[model samples]
Target: MSRGYNGTEYFRNAPGLLSVRLKTRLMWDGRLDGADLPTAVRDMVTEAHFMNADGRLIQERIRQIPELLALWREAFGAQSQPYGPQIFVAIAEFLKTLDGGDTWWTAPCAATR
Candidate 1:
């Protein structure tokens, strides 16, 4: 019911992700927890309508790339192997920094201007 990756579907445009850290609910219908971004990322990535990605497959793929493996090892210690939850958590942390003052609800006057 929303936009997706790789030209997968275009039934409805997805909402922009900027300023999600300020939201109290997530997704078009607010079905996800805005405060729990890692869970949101996990849901979106695994959902067929969204990224349609398998975490195990993604982990395997990343494991094959030496540079990515090295980076992961550096960040997560040498024994880590691109675990799914860890990856989602890292992505959520990065997303937390994506504030562009873009949400109209957070700045109604800016939207009217």
Candidate 2:
């Protein structure tokens, strides 16, 4: 767990924000309501000792990257602009696609089955 100045500890895995998307409560303490993933992501990004980034500043920084902008436009179309909500939602959706299969630990387990 990563501890902040105020002694708020957060989990590193952030599983609810990753593979397990259906979880209701997030963070190590489970204080954040997980009903809305985008909102949760926004909170994480702006939280102290976390990303601590302003949404508009993040948007502008992302917009400055042409390649990233092009990729976002291609993947989500023009309507889905790279604003704070869209960026966070897109990142969450992308993280959901990453499977922890085929690792050494899983491989050994699979062979035994």
Candidate 3:
């Protein structure tokens, strides 16, 4: 389990057995950090679908998906490629999948209304 600065439980029901860096970033973006990545991902995906599709953030988000995050954690933790460029193309491909509609890939959990 992890708690946000506000003491809001970002992730629970799972113990600390496997709280990898990727999970931290995902929950940070999608749930805890107030980064609004899910909203940003959705917006950028829409723009890329119908517009220039060559923005820095859009490209960055592509690189920040789950698979790449996992790859980075493993590679970095193992002292492999210290920097991350191998993930760029893959992330771009992922962004390509975000064509206009809402992508469930990084959708935030529905806030309590």
Best by lDDT: 1
lDDT of 2 by residue, 1-113 (tens): 66653666755644433344656766667777755666667776887766778789888887899888888889888766678878888877765565554456656566665
Superposed model 3: Cα runs more than 4 Å off = 1-83, 101-113
RMSD of 3: 16.3
Task: Go through the candidates in order and give the clash count of each.
Answer: 0, 0, 0
Cα TM-score of candidate 2? 0.67
Against the hidden true structure, what lDDT does model 2 obtain?
Answer: 0.70
Give the 10-residue window scoring lowest on summed lDDT in candidate 1.
102-111
TM-score of 1: 0.76
lDDT of each: 0.83, 0.70, 0.42
Residue ranges of candidate 2 with Cα displaced over 4 Å: 1-18, 33-35, 78-80, 102-112
Tens digit of lDDT per residue, candidate 1, span 34-79? 8899998887789777888978977887899999899899999988
Tell me how far the alpha carbon of residue 48 in candidate 3 is from the true structure, in angstroms, after superposition.
Answer: 22
**Candidate 3 residue-wise lDDT, 10-102, digit = tens:** 443433322122233433235433233343334433432323243455446535676754676675564433232334443434544544443
